[model samples]
Target: MNCRGRVSPGTAAPTEERSCSWLNPWVFFVSALVIKTAFVTVCLVVFLHGSDGQYKTLLQNATEWRCIPSMSAGKKESWTCCPKGWKRFQKSCYYLPADKMSWAESEQNCTGMGSHLAVITSEAEQEFLYNLAKGAATNAYETKYYIGLSASGNGQWQWVDQTPYEKAATFWKPGEPNLLFAEKCAAIHIKGKTDSNTYSNWNNILCFTSCYRICEQAVKVV
Candidate 1:
């Protein structure tokens, strides 16, 4: 009998298995490497996507917080944001400091904050300022607020930024500016509840009068 064609002592495996057994180590190693590479690639992709989503979410929140609500004719519009504790309206930010100051002192205070006393350009701005003054008053007593208008230079009503104040475009009281001889600075009179009709009108007051200041700063483009 031929011993090679039959099962021999301690050699019971088939011929095909015995011939391909030597390649087992290489196949196992290659398969493990491929599995590890695929796992690492999937993890990296997931991590990157998560990080990008989180960043975008944070950016969107920041942008939304920066936008402020501006009111006009009961309609709201988005505008640049204001600093902390300041109010936003149209293209400007206004701050009413609680400390009372004379006209010059108020101007200096505003300059220290990189701003100037409030400048009213249109009726909308004037009304907005009036509302701010009313809120700041917070009592039944009338409160006066100093603005940026002054007639100190040659008796001409002028803004701190040298914008000429047009009499025809002003919101002064009916007989206001009559004391152009002595009163040089301008103020907004916030009347009490009983005198609401006379509230928020521009008045020519003494330069040394102590009053709250309305600071104005232009909103920066985002």
Candidate 2:
């Protein structure tokens, strides 16, 4: 009956008399605190070295976006980033591929790249796209880049992304979208002259017309 610290020959020790010091509530609390402190320390380290270490790795690997420092109301902020070979403007990235394709084909290509054809919703954006297309043009006079605008033969125009056709901005050339040629698709035509008007450079052409295309996508926020 005295099985305090020893067992008799061939006699098994009482199972209920085992030491349970490791099961103390204080022990569990200490272990949990230690684990929590370690996790916090790791997070702080990652945050401190984010510019060149684990934080950057997570952003790059997980979303392929970079956090760039910016300023707003005299306070520091971060700017969302675009992928390589893309140009960042405002809150979107623009891509102008050299290859030419029809309006539908260009839209499909942009969709495959996780974007849609460029939508010109402001004079500033229109100017930016016009300059971009001009720079990529082999012959400015003849170069045209497909945009996101199209018509349904009812003279009602619409963007490929369906961003309120009437409420959005328009940059149509004089007497454009004419029914003479049954033109339904819009493009940004780059004139060779330096004084060419950016606001009135848009022309509606046949949907099947082959031309360069501008693709647009929102920047990814990390």
Candidate 3:
């Protein structure tokens, strides 16, 4: 007997099977496109965030926190901020101790503390020390401070570390170093009258004279 639609055994399925098969490729293609788009979006977001973080780190390292970029309009972009209890100028740290000691004693104390007496190598450094001395003198009984300069018995002026002191680089007051024959040490007059020169004048004095001291050490950023 003829079974018609019921007699499907060993026979290929009709339109429904073909229709479902045709839709599978389109569904898989759409699904794969959506997954690829999501993956790309995630990668782009991560890349952008990493780039921004690196830029900010660069800015921070460049200034050692002394300055940073500003996001606000009309805001200052650079500023100066020193570490606590230490003065920051350029890349050095300075400490002006109020305790009075002899030139040799001051040097010893500084070395004991991992520093040395202020060594003026540039005019900018001199200016900084001079200004600091001026301020310190206001609170000091005698306005003088021992620096790292002295002369040998042979009249050769030298830094405490034995470097030659340039005569042209001297900041002595007029008619100063007058007692060079007897005075072997150098000191800066923080608050004194110089008829024809600037303040913070240098003078040759006895090495044992007691005065305030300035300590200088390098700043390390980590």
Candidate 4:
């Protein structure tokens, strides 16, 4: 049949069918392009407005599944997080439970929670913990929290996590770690009152002495 005429008996098919067939590819192409554009637009809107901007920024800058806050000066992102009721600082999460226990018991408790007793390694960390303990203090003299430090039989101090002990980096109170007594474990004694020498609050006490504890764990990337 001709391009515009209907087919008669025993005639070939009309050109309209060929024309319709030729248009199918362009129609499909346009439909697919519209669907893809709509999908991208929806995704952009959700990303820009439906989610937290701060979290998005942190995720974008994260490396190897680690979030490092730019404001922390190369430190791990504090806001990236810790478990509920725990505090975040640098790359670690700290939990200060209210119940008191012996140094060994405290260490075991921390281990059960997939952590160790706090292994404080810097002045900033010391200060952070000191302040945290101070706020939880009900009594100035009794507000002691067990840390990860312990003394070996040979008088060598060691961290529960096996961090090397450095005398210069220690924050012991003046005249502390008295070898005269059998004090073998270290704790932070919060005086409750502000002092110029705040960071030097650590004291070596009897390992079996009951005190609160600080648990430390690395932050998990969500």
Best by the TM-score measure: 2
Give per-model CA RMSD: 12.7, 7.7, 13.2, 9.3
Better of 1 and 4 by lDDT: 4
Q: List the residue pairs that clash in candidate 4.
A: none
lDDT of 2 by residue, 1-222 (tens): 223456788998766765655558777899999999999999887786876553453443434554566556976565567777888888899999889999999999999888899988888888988888777777455778999988885778888887888633688888876873478899998776453666788888888989989999987644
Collision pairs in model 2: none
- Candidate 1 on 1-222: residue-level lDDT in tens? 113244678976566422455577888999999999999999867865674353333244333324554555866443456567778887888999998999999999999876899988788888888888777786647788999999865687889988777776788887888778889998888777445543338889999999999999876433
For each candidate in turn, the TM-score is 0.63, 0.67, 0.58, 0.63
Comparing 1 and 3 on lDDT, the stronger one: 1
Across 1-222, the per-residue lDDT of candidate 4 in tens digits comes to 213456899998765553345667888999999999999999987876653463453345333333433345776544465566778887798889999999999999999877899998999999998888777777554578999999888888999878999999999999998963499999998765554356888999998889999999988643
Please rank every candidate by lDDT, starting with the best. Answer: 4, 2, 1, 3
Q: What's each prediction's clash count? A: 0, 0, 0, 0
- Residue 221 displacement (Å), model 2: 2.0
lDDT of 3 by residue, 67-170 (tens): 32334378645334433566777767777887899999999997776667877777777878887777666643447778888788888788866656787777
Candidate structures ordered by TM-score, highest first: 2, 4, 1, 3
lDDT of each: 0.78, 0.80, 0.70, 0.81
Candidate 4 positional error at 26, Å: 44
Most accurate candidate by lDDT = 4
